[model samples]
Every structure is written in structure tokens, then in C-alpha cells.
Target: MPIHEKSLIRKENLVENESLVIDGVDVSGHWSTFITGRSLTDYNDDMQDEIAALPGGENIHRCWQCGSCTNACTVNAVNPEFNPRYWIYLIRLGMEEELLRDKDIIWQCVSCNKCTYACPRDVVPEGVMKATAHWLELKGHTPKSPSTEFDEEFSGQVIKTGKIEESRVIMNFFRRTEQPLAQPWLVALIKGLAFRFPVFYLMRMGMAVVRRPRTRNWAKSRRAINEYVQEVEAANRAAVGAKGGH
Candidate 1:
């Protein structure tokens, strides 16, 4: 327990520098050299601004990737590579090509909002995920999402009709699927069991979106939204630059 004895013990454990020893493994006198290269540090400025422009993406600056978001996600338990913490880090770093290639996973996120609930900074990882999906589509990555298909079909219906027709959207959506007839049979089963419901399902959960119809001053709202998006993007670029420099 004396100082010199402890020093002797430490010396006994020490290996020649870079001798490939870890945890008592004697990898010394190795014939080969293994080069484990680190990733090149990058500055991904574009993603910050673009993501901040999304519905809940404005708060991305607050994130400090504690891995809590990924831990809180049910999907992460199923998809090992789908780490929410790493995804945000990638966006903040401006790894555009990687993100585009990763669009499939990004698009597949169920938007369960579990990550948002766990985020200490209120970074809203769920919204950032959606923002990433949109960003992927903007980069010319074709979206392979049922949600994307639903959006396209629903929009077509809305523009064609003044109101959203639930039956029509459901029918059109399933018709576009591989087994078009499966839905009608499923609907019949649901109705037979009295389980079929409408948009009011969300309303019962207190979500205002499904409960009420929205109206907008399109001309004014459009201009205002565009300006806000521009400002957030500028701020995000500045933040990313500052962080990268540090």
C-alpha cells in the first residue's frame, strides 16, 4: 500500500506504447498493424436550417443527444440501427448524402412521439424525424412511405373536394396497395364487430387537429410562414457554423 509499492505494481501492468494490449490481452509482438481510422469531422450546416423550418424542428438547437430519445423509442428497441441520438447528430453535422441514403429508415419512423416526450431539451425528435423525411424527399430520394402515399392520395381528394371524405381516402389508399380487395374485407370485419370508427377517434384522445376544421388566411399565412422559415434557416446556419468552429 506504500507509494513505491503501488508505483512498482503500476509499472508491472504497463505495456510498451501501442503494443495492442487491452484488459490484460497480450497482443504484443504482433506481426500486423491495424489502422482503425476515425471519421472525418464534418460541418453539416444545411440540415439545421432546413430541419428548423419544419413544424416542430425549430427547437433542434437545444438538443444534447443523451441517447434518451433512442432509449425512449419503442421502434429503437426493434431497429438497432435506428438511433435517434445519432440521427440528430448527423443532421447537425450536414451529412446530406448519408441522410439521403438513410431516407428509408427515416421515413419508416412511426412518429409515436415517444422521443419527444423523453427529450429534456424539448428538442422534439419526432418532429425532427419528420423534417428529416421531408428533407430526404427534397433531395430527390423517392419516399417509400404509406404515410407519403396517404398524403398524396388525401391531397388529391381534398383539392378535388372541398372537404375530406373519410370513406374515399380509405378506399383510395387501400386500392393503391398490393391487395386492393383486402381493405373492403377488413372494413366489413371491423363493421361486423362494430370496431370501425372515423376521424373522431383522434378527437376522443383530445387532439385538436381531428376535432376541428382549420381555416387560414392563405395569402397572409403563406407570406408569414415563408418569412419565418427563412429566419429559422438563417439562425440554424449560424449556429452550425459556430458549433463547427468550436
Candidate 2:
């Protein structure tokens, strides 16, 4: 498919002449604009497959470059550079270097799912955006995002106890991200909870923190979940050729 978004073209590839004449006709300024072509030498032919191997990217091949994803994207509405359709096109074409141009912003997707709803081919563009972000991290193009760190903390709690302790999750997340727990907002929230909440409820929360409760007979379930997580992690690393531990 042809690229219709002028913004997708690199500035260096676009040439313009201030004064020009062709066949006695003055084609100057914007009229003399031309796009320089370049050959692809670093295409990763397995890019599509690599992304598809990750969760939420399984439907990437269904995309037909309809532009619905970008048109309906919430982030794109605010930031035109966040173009889901254009990224998918680059991924399918194995244009790895071109895709890396937006590595920093690719993780800004808000998981709004508007693009997923607007897509006609069931491409699940929202998921594809997430998978692309994950692929970037796995390929070492970008560092682990805060969202991923939060997810790990949250998921670790669930897998370990079969339940979530909100306080523990927040504290661990803050620690992993190297943020202090004594922020003004957090302090205010704690004060509000202490005064507004019932004494018995507060006592229960404190006991949970001390006891670290787990679901009844959760050992089997935890084992099964841990095994599944390990398998998925291994597959993800293999798919992107990741060498080191996450």
C-alpha cells in the first residue's frame, strides 16, 4: 500500500527547491518538492512473526492498512506522532529501523481500545500497540516502562497469593520504580483512610499487611500459575532473541 501520511516521511527524505524551472515552466518553492528514495538494506523479515509470537500481536497480520486504527486512536488525537496504522505497516513490511524511530512514544498508548473497536478486520490494534511496546523492550530498543514494572508487581502479588493486597502492591511498585512512599498525595490518602474508615476495617488492613494472607489451599494453584508464567516468559525471550534475564 502507498503511504498517504506526509508526516510519516522523514524530513531528510523530502527535498524542496526555492527556485526551479522545468520546460520553461517555473516550478519553484513547494511546487518543486520531491521525495528522495532509498533502498532497504536492514529489513528483518521475521519481524511480523516475532511480534505475533507475543500476546495481543497474534492478529497483526489481519491489518490491511485501512488507517482506522490511527484515525480512532485516543493518543493520536492528542499526539499526531502516535500513529498505530503507520507502525503496523512498518512492522508488516519488516522495516525494523523505521519502526524504531518512534520507540520512545510507542509506549505512550493509553490502552483505550478505540482503535480495536474501529478496526474492520479484527486486527486488535490496541493489543498490537502493546505487543510492539513489549517487543521494543525485549529487543533492547527501550528500557522497561513504568507500566511494565507496575504490571510485574501486580501480577507477582496475584500469582503468589491468589489475591491482591493493595497496600503491598503500591509499596512494592514504588520501591521497584525507586519512588519514595512519603509523597504528599500518598500521605494525604493514608490520613484520609485512617480518619474516614472504620476502626475494625483499618485493623483488618493492618493484619493483612502483617499476616500476608493467601487463598485457602493455594499451593497447587500457585505452582500451576508459576509454571505457566515461566513458559510464557521463555517463549517471549526466544521470540525476540533476548539473551539476558528480564
Query: Each model's TM-score, in the order given?
Result: 0.58, 0.83
Pairs clashing within candidate 2: none
Question: Across residues 132-225, which tens digit of lDDT does each residue of candidate 2 receive?
Answer: 9999999989999988999999999888889998889988999999999999997888788788877976898879779986788888999999
Clashes of each: 2, 0
RMSD in order of candidates: 11.3, 3.8
Span of 10 residues, lowest total lDDT, candidate 2: 1-10
lDDT of each: 0.66, 0.90
State the lDDT at 196 in candidate 1.
51
Model 1 lDDT at residue 30:
30
lDDT of prediction 1: 0.66
